[model samples]
Target: MQISSNEIAWRGGKVVLVLPLPGVKQTPPDSPQLQALYAKLEGARSGGAAVAPRLPAADYHQCPRGTSVRWYCFYQNRDWNENVAGRRLQWSDPHCDEVMDFEVYSFAGQTSSWVNTGFLEVTVWDDSVHRLWTEAPNSLSAYVGSSNNDQARFFEACA
Candidate 1:
């Protein structure tokens, strides 16, 4: 199912189960979790559309250390429990408009962090079918590199 809106529910509130595109089976109405989620969405819907937050790019750069920068890929999946074997990271960039790949990571209930697997390289192709690539140093220290696209691509390739 296609998720048309990144922001669901109404303004000044929270969203429960992000409604998947229509035609996707609605969550079981009797389920308690589903009920709670429905209530939040209903409140948002009645409250109007002004409550949603603006979403940033699919992937973005961040500086963990004062001088070092790293890339991060963000996403969510219903099946993404705390112990999934693999997670897919998707992102976009100038070199590659869209890229998706599986990566090794551990989710702690709802959040997960990427772990380096030692192989750092962008092994995906751009929208035009041209392969996009980059090289990463053993340590992602300051001045080493600074691009979420490259970091995400490398993890995806390793997976």
Candidate 2:
């Protein structure tokens, strides 16, 4: 996949890191964390649901380092209106009480790097309220000396 700043910020860096919501896949269930996210999305599907359409997974790639690369995740609501709530919605909305969660595991070498050294930024717009949250970077040093090209190729092949 082509690596673009806009795509990286909006999509989860790549498809490999993005997992589908529950009942949408035919493999083992997602992790507990993902399961919770699926629940929130399911709850947001009501007919009168004030909540917007929730996006499960979108990945993007960032080559912040000349040699190393970083992956980011994006979660957004589809039904979110830009002009609602009189332009004053709280962070916690009674109509839309669901919060989307995302996670990424970092690796250094081909093995499970087991290192966490990346962060995620979540942006939400409810027409009345706009909110942003920045998560701390997971500090995994496994990919420290890895080649960015190799990673890019892997993502491309996976795509």
Candidate 3:
């Protein structure tokens, strides 16, 4: 999906990762509601939802090396001690000297009062190759599958 610089900076988020994908091409969401209004919000089903931009194969392939592919959702709590279900991978690059960094977002970037307590599942994708840090879910993790994506370890404040 293509977006203007203004749109990206304002609403595209700090890290805009792909959820349902082929690492190149992703299938469309089944539900129109899920594809349209509901998924585009900030929270999960409550108030925060995010739209997984449908990028064409050609465009996806041409993406820059430093592009950030992010997935975000509402974390329904402030205090966290238990580990949630997730996957850990160390995304790497073979050609470039950069190591793709991944993070299970905390509440540090939620500066707006209008938006709910959201957590970002962020990771940097290089053009060459990628790697994983861990293999299973815990307090901080994320899965890398088309249907099993967005398995992060966070909660919303409303919980």
Candidate 4:
């Protein structure tokens, strides 16, 4: 579940994650969110490859004032209805590569909870990929959502 640092890039003012499409049997057969992700990967690859972005500036939304020269960052959607909060307060060397814990979840209308679907160790870059790795235990589920209307959110961290 790793996309090497060289594969990540910035396009259209957003970070472009070039993901390898997983085979039908590789992902949980019942998780539509995973299926959607696979479709998205296919589309992105069909469109173009990734090119890393330029270095981030101190004034970027995610970077804390005076700390962006060596800071980790992410866009946090605390309440998905409104705007997402960009944060980059963690400290790290400007030239070092970081690994981050990433989780994909689907909203369950019946349970009113997020169902874990795909978990991966993703690499982040200060250029645009700011989240860093964390450790946690979770129970994975095959049927993450009951319908296609279920919303999916990716949770990542900056460390």
Candidate 5:
């Protein structure tokens, strides 16, 4: 999908990373994937129930030195824990360093809020490499996942 900077209307997210896809050709706005992505965003913008897009399953790839790709979703809870979910896809250089870092943070970057609670699922897709990490006081423990690609890691806040 070819979404120039101006086309993206952020509703709540503070930062959205848009990276150049090396080999993947840009798809017209009407393409299925692009359409789904747009609709998903529009639903969220309009405060309607948004459905998660069917993204390509992630598979660990042997990236060349210095190239990597990473995909992740972060959830933060304040008072009572509720079921929340976030998903995204990213493209990275096929041949780069492969590093996956795990860092945890509280909801909305607020460190003094309630204790970290609820479950967060992290899924890495494609062959690119990336890093993830949480901050101190936020207890995040990986629950599952055999490999980086398509692994489901559930992190529950420490009591």
Candidate 6:
């Protein structure tokens, strides 16, 4: 398989990439974890938009360290809990538009639990955002999560 620098890992025959959302990299549909993230974003499934890639440090060169970013979190009872790809997100409010974050996953084989998926971060406003890292999200949170519960949940692990 062709590989590039963006590859975070290729565990258990499944690739775990961490690039920008809607990035040049493509997530193979066969990869459930990655594809599921792609499916979560609106217009991705119905409009055939490309899934966003994971966040890279270079993407935030000019952004400040404590800008405050946000991301999406979605849980389904005891089944699975997934997040919205970061690039697909947009500015929620002036207070929330400060920043956001991005990352990706592709769990396979024995990895069945939510935490086992190995991808979830807090990023902006609680009602609609969470700031995991102090780095500014730049353009990552331009348009992504909404107030929709099943569709979205925003929180930050660290501020």
Tens digits of per-residue lDDT for model 2 on 46-91?
Answer: 4332332243243111112111223322212111111111000111
lDDT of 2 at 98: 41
lDDT head-to-head 2 vs 4, winner: 4
Those runs of model 1 whose alpha carbons end farther than 4 Å from true positions after fitting are 1-118, 137-156
TM-score of 5: 0.19
Candidate 1: residue 36 lDDT (0-100): 40
Q: What is the C-alpha lDDT of each candidate?
A: 0.28, 0.23, 0.25, 0.25, 0.26, 0.27
The digit string of per-residue lDDT tens for model 4 on 73-158 reads 32222221123221111222222243322331111111111111112222332223433222121221222233311222223422
Score candidate 2 by TM-score against the native.
0.20
**Model 5 misplaced regions, further than 4 Å:** 1-35, 38-70, 78-108, 111-159
Q: What's the TM-score of each model vs. the native? A: 0.20, 0.20, 0.18, 0.20, 0.19, 0.18
lDDT of 1 by residue, 1-159 (tens): 212232222212221123233444432112344234334444454564322222234321110111111223222322221232322232212223334433322211221232211233335333344444333422222121232232332222331
Off by over 4 Å in 4: 1-58, 65-69, 78-91, 94-98, 102-122, 125-159
* Per-residue lDDT of candidate 5, residues 1-159 (tens digit): 234532221322212223223443331122344344544554564567554433334321111011111223232221111222122222211212332222221122211112111122222222233322331231232321233323222222221
Per-residue CA lDDT of candidate 3, range 1-159, in tens? 222211111223333322222332332222343234223532332333464444334322211112122222222121111132111111111212332222343322221111111232233222222321222111232223332233333222110
RMSD of 5: 17.0
lDDT of 4: 0.25
lDDT by residue (1-159, candidate 6, tens digit) is 223333242322132333333543332122344334333332232454544433446433211111122232222212221232211121112223333222223221111112211122334233235322222322223223233223223333332
Q: For model 5, how many clashes?
A: 18
**lDDT measured at residue 99 in model 4 versus the true structure, 0 to 100:** 33
In model 3, the Cα lDDT at residue 96 comes to 29
